[model samples]
Target: MHRIRLLTLILCAALAATLLTSVTARADAHPRETGRTVSGPGTPRAEVGLDPATGTPTLAVTRQGRTVLEPSPLGIVTERADLSTGLTLTGRTDREINEHYTTAAGKDRTRSVRMHEARFRFRSTATGARLDLTVRVSRDGVAYRYTLPATSGNVLGETSAFTLPGDAAAWLGAYRKDNENLFNGYGATAAPTGEYMMQGLFRTGSGDGADYALIAESDLSGSYAAAHLTHTAGSPTYGIKLWDGTPIQTSGTGTLTTPWRAVITGDLATVTQSTFTDDLAPASRVRDTSWIKPGKALWTWLAGGRAAGQSLEMQKGYVDYAAARHWPYTVVDAGWYFDPAQWDVTDPDWQQNSWIPELVRYGRERGVGIHVWIHHRDLDTPEEREQWLPTLEKWGVKGVKIDFMDSESQATFQWYDQILAATAAHHLLVNFHGSTIPKGLQRTWPQVMSFEGVNGEEKKTNTPQHLATLPFTRNVLGSMDFTPGAFHKPDRPNAGSDAGELGLTVLYESGIQNLSGKPGSYDARPVARTFLEQLPNAWDETRLLAGAPGESAVEARRSGSRWFIGGTYAGAARTAAVPLTIGHGTWLVETVTDTPAGLVRTPHVVRGGATLSVDVVANGGFAAVACRWYAGRTDC
Candidate 1:
């Protein structure tokens, strides 16, 4: 029996050793077979690895043992060479980036970030052109950009593509020059064939129920035109589509670089919390951002009720409304500078509509600033900008809302840079209307208050589902000028509960929070009035407590010691579980939600870490504020 047992043990040891050798051999050969890889630092590790199966450089990303981004093609196509295929890796370098940064406008004010970056240098076997592909992997996402020799000839476009899983669910917006389209969900295979905007968020359903990938671009410069995604029916791959024009001429010295193509991944919380796009953006160029202040503004374009036109009397009345609500600015929208009949800036009688100076003076005395509007056609040329910008400054105009710049060509981006610089020089805030989606330009020019790249309250398309989707998609990129607060009946044509409209002030983050409701409308509801009065335009901290794109969204934000929570739901009536994890303390919780009678405010007391059951009606919303409660009075 002893002899037999010893023989069995020896046989088992040898078999185990053989299996270990086989596994070791496979692990050792992985780099040579699959190419190079760099992994992010944290739980649910994220890795970007090169695939060289087709003798061309391709990239794939995986997190927590699931594919976030499948093997997709990568290269820059220029007139001199088709560098998309037949590439050989020549050299590679890896590094770690760990830093902390702050932003003037975003979901949160500060961020501490760490990422793993790798530069894989490849030589095109076809033309011998060297292409440097830089891949950076953060804890929650991945970003990459391409760099090529300037002499590579005129750049036609790129071959970079994203191939998602066919089973994955995607929320996409069709391409629009102004980026004012609504998002709709579709299967990756069933996605419509056409150009899509910068943002497209996908759900991988990777068991943890939080796996998502958001496609976006960052650090856009004037030298390169912005890119949109082009999809073909029945295919899961989306390729890069440039503006409708000829190839960009090869100029300048050294190397030409493309903007960072970023994919924010992970669960909903990680996707919302990841500031990777802004992290990839260039650092701020403004020396003194103190003059750039963020606050609420009264806009008279959409929700002015009877007083819609931009006459001097109407402007002063809106300014009075802004002052009464403690809102700092009132935007006198279009028709302010041009003649009502001609709508021309060069009209000899344009100077006749010159109550702007008097209105500015009137607003200044009452502690309200005025922002005038101008048509982009009238302000595109350098000569026109120089002529009108200084005159508006001389009139003490606080800002300019320039509209109808509905293109993202290279020249248009150059114009944007020029206008931002000119406005900065004059210390004038800028709100771009009918513009492309923001790509972290606010960091470079702090004076840029907002961008109307969304189908906001100005349109009846601001449905509940659309509003619920913005936070996870477009608003995640940067400040969105959603122009919330359409509480009145006739203006609120879309299907949403009154509480949802009130909650938008907290749900959307804009440097200039444009309040669109009339004075009488807000006066009737003291609860909403008081809520708006205390809400801050900027936040010290933000969290996506519980949310899913399109279906529902619930967020909690902090401004100093007080915590504000907003929830928006679509589809059907349900109770949302809001976990009050503000801190360990007794607190006073005041909630504004829709009841059968109307919008009402309710207050209660609860300890930290307790869950608050918020009943959100179908296609409705809710807003709440929590503060430390002590003695007989609330700390808030």
Candidate 2:
């Protein structure tokens, strides 16, 4: 028996040595140190390199034989359990990505995109576990993500640096814990250090035909925290840091693909025109999306709920106004259940909120939908969801605008998905306010009407600069219930001229256009009312005729046969050569331009192929449109 045991132990020891040797030899056989280039196949091409020699990988795009990525050392860094130091390349794959998608509701309904992609497989030198870095380059810009080979451990964090050359100008929107917070437009070097909101825009400079780009993440299935830009004061470094949060995740599957770290590239036109998010994100998860509706909604929050925005009579005033304007929805913003004067749902009087059902019934009687606002934390449990959602649906509530999520963890994502599922199951449309950036999730759940992730009129501080920055940033991902159509003059000083506000109505996109400002205030304003009459729920096409982010902006949008063009400028007044695309023929034209007296409309005539020259003043805007039909022709 002793002899047999000794032989078995010796045999086991030999087997262990052979396994270790095999792993070491396999890792060594592959090139441990590699230098390879992943170049773009599309216009304004971006080429990046992946090297295993330096575990600190740099993201450099070869442009004009010069590395577009300013500093050569900016690259990817990561953390995990076995591979605490991230990955080192041990293998490679080069390929092309050609994808097309269509959304029932979005900035544009359909998107098609292609990218040159390269996958560099790496094995941790410390642990034989493997990972892959995929770099996808297209006209929109560059994107990369780490592909983890199934793990049962938590990812501590990532410190990937993304820097720009010559210290490019940038608009850093620090993490938006709420709306009304503005982005800081600083010289690249002076950019505020730390985290940034999703879809942040950065430009080269105030030069002739200078280029700009935006950074954001796509396909967040929630295995990791959202990524944000991080830098230090007076530093030339730019990189990404995971939005640190609690509930360190500890679960996964066969393979975990992190969200795409994407950078949108090109001129303001190109950036605005880019559909990177919609095109590449996972296809819609909702199979039957025919019930999804995108339209304007009236809310009492900005109207200052309860203070002046309270009372059943006042609430019906909103419903009456919505019905009058043919708006689809009228929202009883937070405080309807209780008092806006204070925040607490536990009050016994809260249940006495008979006004909500009555209001919903009134809205229904007037052919309007009723959408209410609520907090995310309030409905965290399945029982709570089971109770509240069904009750709201029974109360004739058409939709909900859930708020104050303030989280980007995996658990939050699961809950979000659950909410969407339950809401859709209830046949209710949803508007996500105080939420994270749209990951093209609306494509998955078309019932998610709009996302209020921008610094809209909610907390004020809005300006022409901020509004212009949006078309290229936040709006790029999806609709922004920028709720922008604020035609009231008093609000214009902080936001823009009445006409600029009108322009915003066209510039911004949303599944629900939640217009701010009291309707009574603008009741005497004919021009403002006329602009509202023409507001469109969905756009057939979008054209960036002229302008850049902060300097100015001009856009031409189409809804069916009618066409609308809007222009706004910042700093010094500027001229924009706006193009027309409403087919060929003479047509009646109307112009709403910012005048000292106020927004005024002038009638004129214009034809297809003619450029509508608009001279806009600082913080001023102009909107003009030509009816699709001619005097004698009926076909528009």
Candidate 3:
């Protein structure tokens, strides 16, 4: 009986092996690659080595020499290593470590190996320790990795830190306003020590820079170190930071650990990528309201500037334009409320304001919703917040834009969470300006529509160089309120007039897209107008077409049957051929939007397995359409 059972098991194992082989072959036949490859479960393979002597892991990248990312045993140690690609360090001291690599394939294909070291560490007399990670990037030598020393309390202490070289600063200067320090005049200045600390920096040209900062903090006691590319000037833009998932104890009250991971790729095309995790202790805290649907998009004023009663006619015209175009919402910008100094949410002035009632009425009449702007500092007190809620609800406001968060204390962070929750209680959507980088709160609070944490069009005067850097840098954190859609040229006052502005509709991801150009601008360029009208702020699917760091990028997005493709160049002009392969259904018709020549409507016949090749000019791009099968149509 035992021999018979063994034979049966062997036969079954052979059958299973054959089935697995067949499935693997089928999957291999239809392999698909999307976006740029990174170190993940599916990453390619490469040879990695760890020095038993020094306990540092070294990666022998093909093009780049043996690159040592972190120290051996990869714990908390600061020493020099080969700084080839850059440095890699673990967030905490006691966390687990992992490594990944992509195998070399064809020519021109770049492969990389990544080592992730994580652990927990404790400081003297400090019941808990915050995670700190430092990764140094260099061109020649091996990258160095070290754990940043955590301070005992809130006060920041000066410690030896690395600063970007002068040449690097000069290289980054071209992207700044007036070639000054990027963070100069923004409330916080770069320390001579050159260590990047959590402090304010002017985002070059956004007028008010007092509210922005670069923050470094740890989420877990010794689990994750987070560097926030933050802003407080009415709106903020987040840079990149690395995060290793771990858990730690909270020091005091009103504190919850949330880990944010970001990467700022100076390379223009693949600029930034980020991930966020909520490190909340299971059932140990106050009411948590982090589960919210996230929506992002741009906005524009339909009425005149925010002064009292400038011209309702202008407001009406703007509202008319939005309605005619079927836009999602129109914003009542800063000037709508009474004087900032005298304004009080409970004051009769709030109740008597004609802007909200009139605009809401007009917007509702036209099927467009209204989002009103408010000053963040004023809402600091609970009384102010309480008064504003009922008023906004009574006014039928769909959303509120909160600006000027301006601080990085634990208190302020808590307040931000409060505002998000408070507004959600009223069913009012929220857009945060002068804020910190998104820590994936949108996933927790769906009503928290969008946030302006980027150096957007407001900095057009600085340089067009920032445009190329943003996609891979600032965009990774979360939805950005870049406020795109200004059709006017640079000559227009305060407009960052890049031809690529049109492409931003496709490049930047937002649920609430604020169309900023004047009505006349869109009217003059009907092709651009049609493009805007056709765009859906929400998308069902998004695809990164083709790109290299700091070069150019092509992207395709799908909303139902309609498809939109946008391509942008960093500095130089380039061309690309993008193939449309979004779905299986055939398109019945096609429409192309091209500038100067206006919208060109064309019809193409496509089948299930056919691909449409498109060519785009330099500093220019193409938007094509493919309608799904409806009724009797066969071509798209």
Against the hidden reference, what TM-scores do the models get? 0.90, 0.85, 0.61
- Please, what are the lDDT tens digits per residue for candidate 3 over residues 26-118? 333322341111122322212233343442333221112211111112222212212222233222221122223111110001122233222
Give per-model CA RMSD.
9.5, 8.2, 12.6
Name model 3 segments beyond 4 Å from true.
Answer: 1-68, 71-298, 301-304, 307-310, 339-350, 491-499, 571-574, 579-618, 627-636
- In order, how many clashes per candidate? 1, 6, 69
User: Model 2: how far is 115 from its true place, Å?
Assistant: 3.3
Candidate 2 residue spans exceeding 4 A from truth: 1-35, 39-48, 51-53, 62-67, 71-88, 94-96, 205-209, 245-248, 307-310, 339-353, 489-496, 572-588, 607-609, 615-617, 629-636
Error of 2 at 68 (Å): 3.8
Clashing residue pairs for model 2:
57-75, 161-239, 162-238, 162-239, 306-309, 306-310
Clashing pairs in 1: 210-267
lDDT, each prediction: 0.81, 0.70, 0.45
lDDT of 2 by residue, 1-636 (tens): 999999999999999999998766544443334335555545444444435455555566544343345533433233444442445666666667777776656657667778877677767676667767787778767777877766625566554566776667887787755433566677777776666776667777456546776877887765656666777877766666666644336456567677787777776777887777665577777777776777777777766555533477888888898888888888777666555544344564543455678888888899888888878876788987986788788887888889888766677777887898899888788888777778757766778888887787654566667766777778878878877665553655334467777777777778788887678755766787767766787877787877677667777777776777777777756565666645688666677876678778876666776876665666777877667646664322
Tens-digit lDDT string for candidate 1 (181-208): 9988888768989888889988886556
Q: What is the lDDT of residue 446 in candidate 3?
A: 51
Whole-model lDDT for model 1 versus the true structure?
A: 0.81
